[model samples]
Target: MDSAGGTLYLKDEDIKLVINPGSIEEGKKIQISLENIWDKTSDPVLNKFETIVSPTVRCGPPGTVFKKHCILSFPYNAVNEEWWEFTLLVKENFQDEWRRIKLGSDDKDIHFYLHNGQCVVNLIHFTNVTLLGYTINIMKAARRVKFGVFGKHSLNKYQLRVRTWNSESNMEVTEDAKLFGEKLVEMATHIDLLYEDLVVRVQDVNNGWQISEASKTQTFSADDLWTKIPWRVFKFTRSDPPSDVLEATISSSQATNVFQLKISCETRQENIRSKVHFWYFISALTVVVIGLIIAWTFDNFQAFLTSHSGIALFLSGLIVALITYSIMWKLVKSATPAQIVACVFLNMSLYYLGVWMCFGFVHPLTTVNIIIILSVYIIAFLVAVVLFGEIVLKFVPFIGLLGSVIFIKLMS
Candidate 1:
């Protein structure tokens, strides 16, 4: 079709990428063949591009709907490179076409990128011939996957600048989901205790592919990677398998208590692992006693602090540390002596840090206030993310004890 001012025009469906742009030394030639139309019924039609284009069929009365499918193929002959890149120019109807339709301005060229291999283009069009305007959809499957449109139909005519976007929704809950409920009810042994079950879920969130048993290397955004899982509900049983598949098991037995697992920022492990720890009545009482002792110590030494601000800072630190320890307790019901000792020391250090900050142990000359503020904010955010993690541990009697022991040692 000819646009107003004698400019040439191509429908959106006809958009194609070119390959093998000639070098500066020699002229380059590219031949585009359009064929193989697919219908709405999923049937394919192999036809020549020239045979399908008719002036009468396209340049009709305004507001007419028109649709067609075609594949554009081109050959490549570059000295070394396998692909070519160029912009596709689109123009609308011939009669007064330029006035009725709008093409992208020079500043924003509609460029095309093509590789040497054969490619397919699916085109669909709707035209208001009287107005000399058209709506077009082009699906470009080339070395790079891209779908685009070009037409002066109207402003806001194309939202997001592209069309023909399709997504698959595979969220059907099947009969197997019922297995989760039945297992929970069957495993319940006492009113005060509940059996926690863990079901591993694995799915491709993006276009990336995943392997079954093989370690599937994947990258996640910082937010997605740091997002916390509900450890209170599902305890990590065994090490995460080195595959995309999730392995989670729940047990009423204390030995199988679960721990929260996070993706390591360094290695980006193929599978995230969580360990299960046990809880017992003895552990819970011990934790509660330590908490009381710490509270008393703070009360007895209230006047001994050098600065009120430092005291406030120390109290804040203690609160944050206790909250974090509580969360860790809920995360693990059992642990080795080394783990318990490590958690306890970490908690003590935090408690002392609170006291020191309030008492001005960290000198203002060192710019410690800035560091303290930032640290407090981080701890608060983390605690919010793992909200009620420790509370969940208190429900399982024996495991709850173990969780308390870990929580207390970590805090004390």
Candidate 2:
């Protein structure tokens, strides 16, 4: 908290951090990592007598001590009945030994409480926390489990979330979901039904789909060393431990899943882009070709850049080539390597050809003239070889430029 008495609260999903005023020296904003570490399900304490109810939530830099008391929350699942009999476990600085803390009276400074399906802890300092307890199994509690796909799959196929929930009626669950637009109600506290109930062996009707992921590491600065963040695709189920969800994973290695990647871009912007590439290939190639024609004609017919017509042509070529390059970058949809290569070469040839026409001044010793001529031949050769290759569209512009080049040279 700052001197202004503004409440400082940082939260992601369910993990929360609320710093009171003067918790860590006055007026100092410290670096915190609540979302940096990956979620874990196993620990040494569980091997003794405790049953793991939820995946371990990790926060860091280990051994961070707070001057004043601060409030922190941990999300938990009711693995079985008697969920109230949970004991909070704290692991400080990645030590082998773990400390057990019970939920005590709030009158004291260091007590925990259950609120809205999460355990709130007010302590001086921390790193990691886990909930441990056992519950009685009730077979009658089983309900119909349903799954739904969330997020725009076409735009971003790399990573997507598949939400699996258990309930009786679809209509009731959906009507209940409408209350929170971007939040999951599965973790909310209830009067009767507990949120941590697991629906085992939920089958995915959609076959041949995989939940694949690559983790990413965020570097706040070049100096601070941080661990690599691997992409995780966990099945964030509403109820119970991950044991049921883990069994559901098929080809995927982790708890995450992925749909296959396609060859072409699937953005809604593709329709407009498809129409433009054809015209752009033609127009960009023509402008550079026109510039080359003007430049070479000026070089041979008149002193280069001396005449008003020559200067205007040179400026036009430079400006239009620049504009074409700018427009090419604006087309931000996912593109094939072939398309990327073609665009790069087209833009390069544009600026290169714009100025390359001056080789007439130094004697055309198989200079740019021969290069453009060979380019046209190569394009023609590819058209003949591939019959209908993608390059054919991008290279068609070279043919037009070839015509202009030949016409201008002949006239000169």
Candidate 3:
């Protein structure tokens, strides 16, 4: 082996293995026995080998042809007056090609590198050991970078962890945890670079995590979702969410401690439009029936008016019943099954009484006509109830009472 070149050749009886140089620091040659070497597996060290550096290891076992001792060379320029020494343990899962140590006049800087799926530590203690690069993974919208306690449990109190926020689109740098949970605040606080279309940021409070994802086009409201969704954290993985959305409307109201938020994202827009169109179609058909009645009245105007006040009364009552039931069901909770049944009977009975009084009692023409026409107005009101009442009921608690008050106030 060349002494000046920082090379060491290992030999065991008749067999030999050549060790190579790395770029980071100065290399050294050492003499040791293969039998006395650390088993590496049983006393597995942390960051001391390539396979174990990563939390998840996909690699296999170590080879058996290693030399008892070997020489190493430093690829990078050596620092002045520094002596290189071999360490038994190195950082875990390190696969770098070179391994070197920096030494001072009185003290040596501990060098770490992974080899043979193990962390080889040459010394028990050394000073001025600096770690070059470390990494962790994160997801987009993941709000927390917690320390002192790791994962969902506190098992890894002193364990250092680093993770990035991963969105379906991108990933960003995050915190690092370490020794006895010290230096945790520094490790947990992180702000990632903003991306092209999506900008993501995270905050770690004493108790919780907050993540905000904003888009170039728009930002949706995320109020009160903490209670609705089971998770305290949220991650958006897709550039575009996959869901069937028909229609979307945004509205807000206040009740109790929480503000009521209404957002509708329908799976099929056409379906909603079809339902609305059907209602309008029914309304138009009713208008046509009214037109027919008017035409017949014009032909035998006086005779028809005199004889069919009863029919007019019946039609008016039917209309009122439809509208009232529809409105009550949509807007108020008080529109119960019993109330609905009672309302229907009352309206029908009123119609019969109005008609009988118009003919049997020879009531005044204006009184009889007014009663009949009023019944028609009642029916039209019911139709209106069916059209708009249902939509209002979802937002109005105590449905009918609230709806009625609001409607009357608004109308007046």
Candidate 4:
């Protein structure tokens, strides 16, 4: 963060992120990343699209919403399939459903456009989003079906929630609570019969699940789903797991087909915490403990390093630390996760190597002396961070000016 906000030139992602100044104050680090989801999972949602035109770019931490939109730009090659000419941006977040985001719609929070081959978007939030292509006919005609079955129960009312939408694709759809309930019975993909003016009719419910008297003969119109996935909850009295839930018949005015749903999921609930505070607590405690240990033994380490050879040996760690920090700087500028991880491990190894050198070459090892050596190495690591980062410059405001004239003389 800087006075006028900051821009991340994510060269590897071929994306740049611009943060509004007031959103984050000066001298704070913002961690954001883009991941290619294609390599990660065999997402069933991807199959529903005509073709995925671009690799899914996941800007993380997942599900982060911003007060104001950030500028997200992708290079020409980022989504440059031949199908891109007829593509739509399909976005998914922590929310399970994938929705279509239209192109060149100025009012949309997720609008994107191709300008001289570069796709630029106003990123309103962090989510996994990809450019998805649809057939020209499918784009011209929105006649597809996305259907699901969700389990529900309240006292004796054992229920099966049948949800349906136009299914061509949707945005502005709220997550269905029944499908993601405290006791969710995951159903396999629902059978769909694509037709205009379709109606879902419940013919029968048997084999341990009986249709409640109120819903047995009633029919549900697809017109109700035009605006959203209207929940058509049908309550059925049940005896534990049902061998058959319902025999649903989907019909248009003059045609029909039987769509049966049966999946024996032992009703389960996924209890996932969206945010983690445990690691942050552990990290803070470790830093405080390390600081206290260093303060306790730093005097002895200072006394031993008063001579020329000892000073030379101590300064030698700086050369290695400086090189490691430079590599980390480059990796972070581009935001390559794997390389950044490797760089951090290498830096830690080098930090420990300094303590080893102190024990091996200059002094006899003891628990008391080892703590002193560790403290010296820790201080050296902190000095490297101050030199290589903008932290000191931001606080002092004129550190560069003051240090330039006296750096060489001070080092000597």
Candidate 5:
């Protein structure tokens, strides 16, 4: 047996044969083997010389079809002597049944039909007899390939999977292929998803903190033979736990492939509450500073100021409470409308306190005293306007009210 040329020769005691290479490809190896015949139903003499030729062929990759042709040959004497018959069988795998290559009318005795008896049975006109080897064409099928991120979390872990299936059916088929490598992080800290020619940004939406430049991204490619998509790991700052929703954008060149993933952050409530409390304390300190400045500058009017100290202290406390509530409302995510109303009421009280203090300090109406009192009033008004612009307008009504009260009290 010649493996590369698909030729065979048998000169054993029981058989004398020769197989010539027909249309077999040059330098291509075809597998050949012999088997014993045990079935009594078959002809004993003909079955003794049976031989099998097996060759493994592949249809080109993913989306193509290819055809291959070959031929088998035998000794011319075997046909004339009638000692045995040859059977040519081909199969793709051991589990499949062998397909017989049928004999065609092209088979003829080269010596008897052309040169007459001048050539003996062994000395045929043609060196070897030929049989048509079956021609098989295989078509490669196309499949739909899908890639996506399966699961992701703030822990900086992501799982990715790729699936391929026949475009016309729901069944999934395996493909022995690979996906190209890509860099998901550019310049280290910025995590990005680039797929199908589009780039999507992964953002830390829950916590207000931006992803730090020192953070790193890790990627894991799929180990499965079929799925080759890569998963990305993004490390965000964990000093403050993530917010209620952690979001990232997934986009592709095609608009239909764009989507977003939102994951819940279970550990964010405590962090939010702490921030609210901290801002509230800051607002309270701001109010106390304003109150002390007012008290210290009015030392010359201590006797008169002491008489109204009760109202002054009550108004100062009201201003502090309003400032704290407003700050908390802005900082806390769970604040209610009732808390907003309370903040508004406290702001109105602060405005009234500003008007009352303005009148109390300017009552004597001396030029020197007016300069000092007006300067303090201007400073407090600017602070309120800068820090709490939304509630600062409540002081407008107090301006008119103060005028009426001061005129009546001083004239009477």
Candidate 6:
């Protein structure tokens, strides 16, 4: 062989050859020759021979900081029958001189050792290792690395491992690594299914608060995947009403996860018209009962007139004026408090006079007197029903007793 740019010939029986390109300096000429040694009992050494078989390295998803186990397999045919020693080297893409990776139990990350004719390593805490003389922060940008597997018989193979953030396996590795990728895809599919099955519901505990029914019980699907649910505001008339705390729970029929949220509900408005009607009925019933009691107590007018003629004449005239005013108010269709009171008084007074004429003027204990009292009571009840609607008619007896007490106090 010439020291510089020379060609060499090899025989078919040759087992090994070594070339040193660095020894040939620039502008130098040298010739080389080889001679075979014929030893009687010594076997031929094939330490310089290169093995064609390469070791396979399988890793998990790339670009992930999470710890993962990587498998390394060496072909059984490539290994020596007795024993074989090899060194694994790794370096970042932009780095020079691959660093020797230690093989022992003391390593916390990136550990590789032979096990059952294959290399196994846990790259859980693996990071780019800095060269002893270099000062650059290579680990920060080290996403890819070149690994070298070297054997004693000059057998070596260099492979590249690229870090990826996705579950896709870019390297042609072991069957186990492919299965791990499939599992990642399956987990993601399940999460998507659970999200599609989620259901949301909103309830109105207070009827006074007005909320749109369309906003309640909203359903979400995978198409509307949201990290945060949309906020729904309560609407009301006049002013913002008092709020009640509301709870929202989100659960999927197919998932075990449960999420909860809280909402505030504004108070509802009151029905003013209904309230006013209720009070008006009470006032009308009170007036009716008071008028009936006054009429009943003054039925024996002649006896009272004889004792206190001046007072009896004044009260009798006042009662007559009130009855006339009540009749006129009703004809005008005026629904003022005073008008209602007057109408109630007139109706009860007319009933009382009819009863007094039939019963008090004759024998009070007779069957005809009892019949007249019953008929007067029936007529008074009918009048009350017409004036206040049936809601107040049921309380007539109670109202009468209450009004009688008030009338007695006034008379005294």
Clashes found in each candidate (C-alpha, N, C closer than 3 A): 27, 11, 55, 0, 0, 5
Q: For candidate 2, what is the lDDT?
A: 0.43
What are the per-residue Cα lDDT tens digits for candidate 4 across 326-382? Answer: 554443322323454455445544544554454454344456644654465446545
lDDT of 5 by residue, 1-412 (tens): 3323332323221112232443234554434432222221221122211311111111111111112222222222111212222333333333444444343223232211212201112211212222111112101111122333332222222222222111111111112222222111111111221112322345444453234443332223212211122334343433244244434443322234344444333323344455445555554555445545544554354664566644654565556555655554453443333444355444544554454454565554455644554455556555665687424433422332333233324422
Model 2 spans > 4 angstroms off: 1-8, 11-71, 77-89, 94-116, 122-124, 130-283, 286-412
**lDDT, candidate 6, at 245:** 25
Give Cα distance to truth, residue 88, candidate 2, Å.
3.6
Q: How high is the CA lDDT of each candidate model?
A: 0.27, 0.43, 0.28, 0.45, 0.33, 0.33
Q: Once model 5 is optimally superposed onto the true structure by TM-score, how far is the C-alpha of residue 67 displaced, in angstroms?
A: 58
TM-score of each: 0.18, 0.35, 0.19, 0.30, 0.27, 0.17
**Order of candidate numbers by TM-score, starting with the best:** 2, 4, 5, 3, 1, 6
Assess the local accuracy of residue 75 in candidate 4 as a C-alpha lDDT between 0 and 100. Answer: 45
Pairs that clash in candidate 6: 62-164, 63-163, 63-164, 67-124, 208-268
lDDT of 6 by residue, 17-125 (tens): 2223433445554443322212211211112221111221212122223223322223212223223334444433222344555445465545655555334444442
Best by lDDT: 4
lDDT of 2 at 353: 52
Model 4 clash tally, residue pairs: 0
TM-score winner, 1 or 2: 2
Residue 191 displacement (Å), model 1: 51
Cα RMSD, model 2: 14.4
Q: Please report the TM-score between candidate 1 and the true structure.
A: 0.18
List where candidate 6 sits over 4 angstroms from the true fold.
1-121, 124-195, 223-241, 244-412
